[model samples]
Target chain A: MELTRHYLIRRFREYYHKAKIYEPIEFRMREWAFVPLKNFPDFVMVRHVSFSEMEELREFLISNVPAHVYFSSAYYLKPSAEMDEKGWTGADLIFDIDYDHLPTKSLESAKREVFKLLRILEKDFGIDEKEIEVCFSGNRGYHVHVYDERFRELGNMERREIVDYLTLRGFKLKGTQFDRVCKIIHRYVRDGKVNVDEKTGEILRSSLNEIRKGRLDLIPPEVREELIERCLKKLVVHVDPPVTADVKRLIRLPNSLHGKTGFRVVLIDLNDLESFNPYVDAVAFGDESVKVRLLKKVRVNFGGERYILERGRHSLPEYLAVFLMCRGVALYGH
Target chain B: MRRPFLPILPYLERYPFLKIGSKLFKFSKDEVLSNVEKARDFVEKVLEDKVEFDFKPIDFLCSNCGIREECEGYEGCSYNISSAEYHLKLSRAKKAVLNWLRCKVVVSNLDEFLRRRFAVKLARLYRDLILKECDDFILFMADDFGLNHEGFSIHVADYLKYAVRMKSDDWKLVNRFLSKGYVDLSRNEFVRLMEKVIKEILMEKVQINLNVRLKVDFKRKELERLPLKVECFPECMKSILSDLNEGKNVPHTGRFAIASFLINIGYDVENVVDVFRNAPDFDEDKTRYQVEHIAGLRGKGERYVAPSCETMKSWGLCVWSCEVDHPIKFYRRCLSGGDKGKRSSKRKGDSQDYA
Candidate 1:
């Protein structure tokens, strides 16, 4: 089902011709990179590219029609120079919540994780709701960026702590700080909020008095661990570590089309995120009929349509056809 | 302040103190000359003391950790700090003398090295005194940062300046008492960061002269001379070398690490190039140029060292858990022909000024 490089490039060009790709915030201060749609599933990014004017980025997008467009999260004095030569001014603190990295690997899980992350950022980190910019990655995750000047100059170690805070990595529930974790476990065990086997549940039920008193050892170690794990699961926010830690990371640009699924990398307000549907809302192509040879059986479920297709030549709406073709599950011009 | 004398100082930040001694510390010629002798005596006394520091949690519910609910630390401050303040200031005055010495002059890496050790030693004493006096001083410092201590937490934004500087995993926010809108700290946590801040500030001011000679003879033993021994190579390095010698397409990190290690271990560019002869895509000109570049001949002209053991582990180059912090440490162990050999080289003499 691998599409030819020429096919993807040609298809990508058509989308860019009318894509209306917009620049990221602080466009002139950031470095840009592009990995052209070629050699399916493999790409070498061309970076250290910048633009002084609006027309340059626009013209370049039209000419290049990059498969995956990215811009540095950091602001640099010389955006097009070598890494060491480019003076580092500041960077946006980024958090990535990819569904693939989650235990369930479901979009529903990713949404829940993003909510947990937002809560921690808003609550623990005290980052304002308005200051947090959440964007659909146009693929499998959400990219949350904080452009607050206070958080910008945080070095790698500081960001490492922030990530560790979100994930609760190496957090121990035994000493001076264990009181909070004990409280969390107590509520879960006492209220039967934890999911465990009947015997473990019975143990938790039997140890209600001890649990209420924050004495976890009154129950079996297995049940104790299970309760603690499940309780903390609600508290831990799953984020891709490197995306947040790496100051120089080049993130997929908003408003640019994700070359893989031919969807727009769009931003969503915090209020609207609950109902945000990437497949439906992120679709950039219109419903003009187009010919495509389906090489693999696949399902198209969003954008107010559902089609379980077979392997054959079929005339589909341009929106559906482009998605299938760009995903490399089909070929153009049946 | 009194301490045992250091034989020879360790390698420390030398440039700031030596290169800009007078301008940095803002001392006049007479003031610098006279105080240098006084500062040397003060440093000798300060270095003579054995500083013992330990933080054991007392399990007592402490307040003023910027958190209101609860905190971990020793007993809370229960007494008036009128004398405590005087005691703290006395230490500060003594430390200021050493601070001036640290900033004013450093022979090679001499004073620079001693300053770092002095700061930490003094800081440990400072932290204990602060704890004994009560968290009032700690709270006072936090207030300077606009950090408000409430029920077992401080707002993350308010405390990041101090917390961000904490390197240990135990000091990570995850290990702290976390609540909605706050990160909790114990008494020890506050004092630890406060101590580090004291140490950093301690190194910022000092007095000494640009033209002075020490009547001390000491080998530069801090910069260890390691022999070119392949057998002494750590497993991580050995694997990379063998891979290149076997015409394998080693990862970029592996190649850089091996090349840096070879260059650091006294391999000539031509000799290193010969090792890469069997590389998958070996090109003589490119290999030689890269080797030369790593040897600090071209571009930045900064010689590269092999990545540390932690970095090696991160890069997945480590084949086994080598009991050393760096590949070079492993090599040193091999050369010593033991598991871990210790060395002590000390040279002590009074530094005299010559007109």
Candidate 2:
């Protein structure tokens, strides 16, 4: 049987009341939007809030639980006003790395990709360890927030440039000094401006030319092909560019329960990011068994475990039951 | 005995020529043959530091002197020297240092070149001795030498100076440090320093997670002016740009569609690449190469065409219908005239051609 919207909202409120909510930096200045179950998804009410006002907001949520909760990445003097009139201040640099956005079939690789982007920010950009924050989306993604004071006022073009650098967009091999060395040694260009043999005269041009022509047999023992390969590999990182570029974006509020998954969007430490499994770690409901009627044959991976469902009645953990019911695919009291 | 006025050895060595009243001459024993023995004995005693000699009335060249710019004299001129000579020396020093760092010089003669060349030795003088011995010379060099002029030459000396300037504001201390001399470092150590400095500079250039927006409004006004909006875009390409702009990772195929469509529509490679800046793992060189490849600027000279509307529909990328068989046709029609000829026979002809 399908749970009534009222029952779903009530359970969500209970989960919210029991869970420990994360406090985002400068939480008081953020704009919040709530979509109620009674209205269309597009219909949302926005409000400006401070940390001190969170208790009242929580009380409102508990009374009439929203279907979805979203917070602006931007800060404003007066939020919930007309777009042109709101006294917008600044925003945090947020990155949303979603598994569904990538073509990878397994969630494992997608999570690895997220780590890869984060590592670039840490190692290449030299961002301080504490300045970067990672969190689970409570569904199929990771969100990274950068709260460095230096980045607050960057415009979209500058943000886009950062994204370009990270993603290797418009990066030219011809412009790189290392690649120029490789090209000169291998005679890829006819310009005599680059004379590499003067240093290591042992590198004969005939052999280099043969190697350049794809005749690997003519490769000299002194030539380290790996050097060129390594330089080439250093050129690019695959990432979603728009996240860094969009200044006025909305992000799912941390510590809020996801409407569909019945999972909590929790902040995760960078050290613990690799081992974080959203299905297991973010489950908001208790382990009480509940009877749910499956609407169709489906497979799900949740809470670090997999479940296969057939088109029939089945007993599931309370969180999974709520997840399916909220997804509108199963009836909990059939 | 006719006493010859013998000059101070340190001052003489720094300025080998002596001004006899108005005319400057090399300090030769022939000029004062009557007291040659006395001069020789005075020079020997002065060299041995056994006797202190008084400084001669030296004539320093002024900047206005004709010989100042071109003079290669070993010591101070009879007239005041021009800053142009100092600038020339500094420029050469920067070039020599950069050349050595870039491995442009013959490895065997590097030490000899460094010691003999004015360019190389002058750099050493500033970096090791002059800055400590005299503040005026360092000030002179600093005023004459420019960081902007050193093109394509990466030297640790300049990099260190830049780093120091970036860190501290005390010019006196910085000048003192420069004069006190850099530690004797191996060639490889210098190279490593240059590499580290370059990497730091690159990191600064590639700033990450700056919460800034584009000052140049990203809205393509021309695109907006077209009769067709994003609704005309194949769902795949539209979603790809949206996802990229929103910082959501997109499938490779989605990226390919956007790139191909943008390239086909005559968007510059940089603009096309800008669209992908929000991609999760972006690399400028790689994206440029990829976009260039799709644009037929790289690879085997074959420009990639955007996938057909029917193919996009098959891939579930077509969420709306415009009755056009191809994406290019839709875009073309949109650019030409939007909705005015919605029921035109031109679309019918395109449908029949595909059918």
Candidate 3:
């Protein structure tokens, strides 16, 4: 697999200005880090830039086009050269819903998992939808950012508790204390009366009992247990553990180009997530054809289209060629 | 020129029991703001002079301290200035602030626009003055509200309804505090703001009150009480009672479950106390008070419910599938003269309930 440096450099110069870098409200008060070059691979940290100097930072990106760009989730007061020296401020609670953590391998399955987590965050924790920001990671997953101020102040232990609640870990089936009567057959119970047999005068157990003809003399004892088991099943939402637990961890910048996928890190509308196809929506390049040489036979399924390539020169769409080159499976041909 | 402690005055009059030390104080918005200002001045004064509260214990007063019985020279004497003088002062300050919040402070006299405007200014002042030094307190308060625990203590939610007769009445205000955006207050923003300010002003000693006492043991004695039937008890309850009867140590959850279970089944506080008398570490007064608290005869007048089947399962105390949803349901059947020997027959056709 080969990738031409000149092609990447030229592409970065052309489209780097258009790339969007997510900045905290206090941008200057954060520690920024970036991969200077693909060959170097090491992330050079301890960089700081004010809002006014964003243009200079953009120009630097145009010149170098770092392999990856990241700003600390944390807002620091000192933001020194060493991490320990920096005074910690609060951060946005970001959940990395990667495909690997999901029960199924498909992106569709990952989306379902992400939605389940979103539901738990909303219904259980009462976090508002507007406070949550969803971003496609431009590779293999989604990044959900909860910008709610309440979550920002949560420590690692508290954040782990949220993860525990989501995953249903440490959830005891017998410990659930509900003051209200169980809802399962309560709907059928009208005016404090259960359907009863007239002749023998026995109270019939309603919908919750399988005994259609037999009289339910008492409230079923297992009604609460059954409801709890169902609740436990619904509560088990899979999430990438490390991502939620790390309060100070840096995340992929939203709307910025992912160096590995050659696709833009796209911001998704929570209401429109069902229709959001990352490959189609996040293509940063035009459809003009470009010549590329595949180092090996490559089969790519992107957007709605699929392509099979042999180890030879082929004229492909500009976006597909760039994607292949970025993936390091093809080279720019003269 | 200031609002006449309008919102909180009624609350203080209603709940005379909400005393901050010797004084049953009526705390207002102005009082809270003024306290913040005072605490700021105190912080600066103490920081400048380095006049710190000494945590060291004085050896002579160890016998007279209220907590000396439990202290046993192991957890150190509680006779220090921090606990004696400053701790009381802190507890009072905390109660004042908590009472201020407990009384919903929306004013009819002030203009709606001015109210929000003043609220924003106050929120910002609290954020700047209090948040920097007392972040841990704020975090603790948040957790204290958010997490549910098995105990006979007053939760933040309980305090929110300081004078409210019913949970539903207080829940209406809580729902408003948490519901969709209230003009300038965007969803739970107000709650978060109030929590931070309250935490900053509140002293750590009074943040959680777990002390329980029996106020009406006579009234409790008049109520019809039943003998605890161990044979008919749920597995979890039976296990806890067995542990206590054998003078074996049980966890707090177990104690809570047992206390809640016995009380819910119409057993009086004294009977419940007798059940725990054999426990190795049982204290008669403490056990009686805790039992009274769980029986809803003391403290907040709210009886503790037995931990649900799910809670027992989580605690790893749920041993058998009794096919009952709640421990209370099992106990209710036994207490109501339902056939205990014929209980197994009730489980025969209940496939869907088990499913």
Candidate 4:
């Protein structure tokens, strides 16, 4: 059994009828896009549409029942028009932390990166947490957006430089940032943590200031790159740079359903993200019985219940069935 | 035309590269050149190889201006601009003598060229002054740049723009100096960077009004026209071209990348512009301007390379998980190896749809 397109559409329509779409700040200026239930699993976007009011958008979503909904990170004068004519004003600075790009491929790792990114932004860039919006991307990531007015006007090069800073792409031992790195290595050396050769060991052990003008270069290229890589693993964040750089990118709208998991793209407060469980909190369906035949053995602890499903037809909770069906692991049963 | 006695003439005769902010006394170039004696005399010092970089740029420390080593920080920034101004005139005179030393033509054999590298000392002199100009003299240079000296830092955006032409890898924001939305600079570091910026600005601005032809080696145009092996074109470019061929609305960054890449690879403006015609929003006027600008034929004359693979990926424009880290290398690898071209050409349509 496979997930039928009709059942998926019906479920999506049901969710949209009650789903409260979190409209972007400048709702009128943003170009909206949606992947309709045209071809299942493979979403082809039909974009260059704009709405004047939130109510109109809500009505369209409820009736049309798009599989995935999105709004432009940018605000344009003629958002509904062709690309050239759509006069771009400014855009929200978005840092999309997909799990695929992180040091570890897990939602928790992505969340930790979110915290790391925020800390870096606050300490280095002087951005306050209040001005940023953090949202669970409903699949395997989080989208942290900077909506401060000054950041809106930053062009591609400036944005890319900021990305370079976060990723520590061009970091060399010369600045205040590297001074901190030097001091850390110095402390580690003094404390008998890291071993080194005589010449390099002497430089590290001598003084922090000496290490600043130090012979880190005396270390081999593999060792130096490995050290940088380790630093990257610790301090650098793996934000999808293109997402931040693309001023007119269409991001997943908050409070909308993800086509892959039938999970809500829920917004979370910055200070209150530690307790969020996407499997439980982001679940949009409840415990009503629904027939689904598993195409493969699935093991997932979803919504606080462990379901070890084998390849066969089974009557499962509506939430589990929808999750499995949306995941393309299960289908509408006979 | 009557020649006017310009108040800034003395200043100009000193530091030819120094910018004076006044149109108070307007004079024509013809009127200035009407006195051919002054022009010849001005140009002669350069011809004789008399311009030397020495104590002239640094003697502004003053007889009793009270600029101690400790005072070199922001505390000493206020040490008598008037006192320094007069001393600055002397330095300007020396710089103007050096700066306007514009046209001493030298034709030499390679051994002679190597032996008589007269510019080496002048360059080292500038570099040393850049490093050691920690006192009021360097502060005057910063003032000329019109940098905001409020709390000893410039905004990140303000500084990153100029950081492009910086010579050292140290000037990169990722290296250090970025903090709290501003790029913090120590006084010496600030002076060093401004000196580098001044060097570039001088090179860009100090074009002589006179045009005298001199023999120089020029590459023939025919050599650049040899067509690239068509099959060796990278997949990412083909993907972008295919999108444009179907009249897709490519983003502005994508357009810039493709245009700059093509121009760098010796594609002419007309052919480049033609390639962009398949764009849905293509306006010939806009396209030409954009194409010519990237080709470095107009506006700043600063040619751009196609962005690195990292940058291309950041723009979401990478169509392949290519082995090489640069698009140019991708093409080069195809040229050198020739195996990747065929295999990648048979790629599924789905992966090629990067737009």
Q: How does candidate 2 score on lDDT?
A: 0.54
Candidate 4 scores an fnat of: 0.55
The residue pairs in collision within model 4 are: A242-B314, B14-B92, B14-B93, B15-B92
Best-fitting candidate, scored by TM-score: 1
**Sorted by lDDT, highest first, which candidate order results?**
4, 1, 3, 2
Q: Residue by residue across A1-334, what tens digits does model 3's lDDT show?
A: 2246567667755777776756555666666666654452234543543233667668767766776667777777765446545777777788888888665776777788789878756754557898898888888888898887755766554575556556655443211111112242343343334433442223433343432222222444464345445545544677787688777788777777777777888889998898888877888888889888888999998865778788889888888888888787888884
Clashes of each: 23, 53, 19, 4
**Judged by lDDT, which candidate is best?**
4
Model 2: runs farther than 4 Å from truth?
A38-52, A174-238, B1-355
User: DockQ score of candidate 3?
Assistant: 0.01
lDDT string for model 1 (A1-334, tens) is 3444565677667777776666667889999999876545576788999998878887888787688899999999999998767888878999999998898887778988989888877765667887888889988889998976677876665787788677776576643235546777777766777777788877777877666666878767876788677667767788998889888889988888887788888888899899998877788877888888888788877645778999988999877787787777888776
Model 2's number of clashes is: 53
Give the distance in Å from residue A2's predicted Cα in candidate 3 to where it truly belongs: 9.0
The reply for model 1, stretches above 4 Å from the true place, is A1-26, A36-44, A52-56, A59-64, A174-184, A191-214, A229-236, A293-312, A329-331, B1-115, B128-136, B142-169, B180-182, B202-355
On a 0 to 100 scale, what is the lDDT of residue B326 in model 4? 70
Two-chain complex of model 2, DockQ on C-alpha atoms against the true structure: 0.01
Q: Assess the local accuracy of residue B208 in candidate 4 as a C-alpha lDDT between 0 and 100.
A: 34
Candidate 2 per-residue lDDT, tens place, A206-282, comes to: 45665454343344444445434443444334456677777777788888877766778878877777787776777
Q: Please give the ranking of all candidate structures by DockQ, highest first, separated by commas.
A: 1, 4, 3, 2
Chain B TM-scores of the candidates: 0.50, 0.31, 0.36, 0.56
lDDT of 4 at A87: 86
Indicate the worst ten consecutive residues by lDDT in candidate 1 chain B. Answer: B4-13
Residue B31: error of model 2 in Å? 68
